[model samples]
Target: EHKGAIAEAGGVKALVDLIFKWSVGGDGVLERAAGALANLAADDKCSMEVAVVGGVHALVMLARNCKCEGVQEQAARALANLAAHGDSNNNNAAVGQEAGALEALVQLTRSPHEGVRQEAAGALWNLSFDDRNREAIASAGGVEALVALAHSCSNASPGLQERAAGALWGLSVSEANSIAIGREGGVAPLIALSRSDAEDVHETAAGALWNLAFNPGNALRIVEEGGVPALVHLCSSSISKMARFMAALALAYMFDGRMDEFALIGTSSESTSKSASLDGARRMALKHIEAFVLTFSDPQAFSAAAASSTPAALTQVTESARIQEAGHLRCSGAEIGRFIAMLRNSSSILKACAAFALLQFTIPGGRHALHHATLLHTAGAPRVLRAAAAAATAPLEAKIFARIVLRNLEHHQTEPAI
Candidate 1:
């Protein structure tokens, strides 16, 4: 009923003014006011209102200035709720950014009070959804702070590790931030979290590694930090679909251009060749390809699941297949058929991924694997590729790659019999 009264009385602005005015003098009044703002911000309509009236600034100030841990926690919660509201306006995130909320939130992440730390981490996780906010967090030294939080003892609350890893996952999206995270010695901690008993921590850590893998240099750093075996273990053992998905994504990134490294595993006679290590990673990846496909078959479903937990963009599906193809990983005819189906019915992203995977399968190194699968002739793959090449909405990279695949498929078909 109080919530309804607040909503009736000019909504979030009233709450913001009360918070600002009371926060200066009365601890009891400030806590109540911040708590009200947190509740109001949970409602999407009130979130935009809160941002418009400068409530985000008040919340950040309250969190920063409050001596009471409870007040700080509540203020952080309000900021997080506002950021998580997900209104198209993005005003909440913008206001928080302008108000210097990120720096305050980063400070809270280190608070001795566990509730304060958890709430601050959660708020940063929400704010990190904005690319600019991510850059700001990283620029403000949030990456090292977050990594320290995530590296806390195993007995620590799972929520702390989850939120810290999640924020790191967001920071890892930018190439420069990815390098910063590696430079801060974040890779080993993240890899360690992947082994946590808490599924959320495991999943979030995998996600951070996935994003970090986007930069080739970071990918190598991850590999050197023993990330490959850890990810492979998660892919094979985890019950959470998201965990397995992220594990596969991390592997894909780590091995993207290192196909020849894995290939060397089979032919090299030198006992000291890195092939032994590469071989284990390659076998694990090939073994889990079907699971990866199942996990990503419906991009929308996967995206929805991810957003429910961490509110980040989905991993590019094509990268997974491209890496597998680069390693000359073979697929069954049924799997090729699935790619054809995706080409026909999936979104442009998946279509491009499928087309490119088929393209790789036609290369000389990959051709022998497809001998048993008539994907080019019987499955109408060429028709799908040609259509994708001509589609208006297809990404230019997709279209060009599709055309190249079609041309190659045609050449393979028209060649004289030996």
Candidate 2:
């Protein structure tokens, strides 16, 4: 209420000015002023007001140079709120970068005060949403600092670990930062954090792994560090839908071209009595494929719900049912049609997963399965596959898989129907 009143009266500028003027004074005044700014920054209009009056610079300075931990904490929180506010112009992020805020935030990540560290890490996490700020933070040694903070204490508070891992997740978007994180030994800590008892830590760590896995070398490093089983475990059991989704994405990246493994498993089980077990494993794999297809089919809705910071209960239930249904059913024209539709999804992840699943149908036995089910002749499947294969935004691996599916489909088209 007070914050709304302050913004209504056009006192945000005055509050930001007071923050700068009172910083040299004792902690009480500085803390109060910073707190006020933090509250005001929560509103988009007031955040813009704060940014216009050079509030970001004042807050960054307090976070950097203030002797009082409380003041630093409040200032960092204020900067984080401003950076996270929905500003299409991204003015707060730009102002922060201009003020050299990344370096100071990186320094604060190492602060002895946990609150300060958490808030600073959160600020970095928000700043990292910008691609340019991502490069800036990475060059400022933010990746190494974040890795250190993530691993600072095995038993660190969840808030600290969550924000640190969240920052790492944001940083991992850059290929350079992904390589830097691996060089800094970031994989082991992330693997360790994925096993954290705290749900937030586990989710953020899984998310970081998802982003980092985009780099082949980093994916190999993560698997070498036992990330595969950890991720698999999270996908199977974690209550957080985001965690499960991220783990699945990491697994997808890890096994992008390894169709041979699926083939080997599908064919290796020769025991007559073990057929049920083989079927169960195949069903499980199908379930995962179906879940990915459904979730990424509409990326905008999924992103908005996930961005709300809510638990994954609704998504889990919806996707789980789809997975179960897909698992029970064999390859069908309807299923193939769904995969073809996913080829046109806005999300690269969805397009990639759909391509990967379709690739499975091109394998030796997989081709036979699709032929028997008449899934290859599903109307427009070939055309859609060709389009997705040539899509500019689809991942390289997705395009490759799509091209392979199209080649196989072309071969089938040339053959006379039985």
Model 2 C-alpha lDDT per residue in residues 1-418, reported as the tens digit of each score: 7766787787887877787677677789889888889888887777888888888888888887888889989988998898886335575466456666888889988899999999999999988877788889988889889999988857778888899999998888777898899889999999999988788899989988977876667776776587766777787677776677667767665554332233333344544433454344434444564455454344554344334433343243233322221221134364466556667766566687767566555432342534723576656677788788677777655665566566556656666776
Question: What local lDDT does model 1 show for residue 162?
Answer: 88
Off by over 4 Å in 1: 1-5, 259-275, 290-418
List the candidates' TM-scores in order.
0.67, 0.67
Measured by TM-score, the strongest candidate is 1
- Per-residue CA lDDT of candidate 1, range 1-418, in tens? 5665677688667778888678667888888888888898887777777877888788888987888888999999998888885436585457456656788889988899998999898988888777788888887779888878877635678888888788888777666887888888888889988988789899889888877775666776777688888888887788776677667656754554433443443444753465566667656664564455444345553344334433132223333323332433334465566567656643444555455556556653353434523556777777777788778886554565565556556566666543
Clashes in candidate 1: how many? 0
Residue 158, candidate 2: Cα error in Å is 1.2
Model 1 whole-model lDDT (C-alpha atoms): 0.70
Q: Which candidate number would show the highest lDDT if scored against the true structure?
A: 2
The global C-alpha lDDT for each of the candidates, from Candidate 1 onward, is 0.70, 0.71
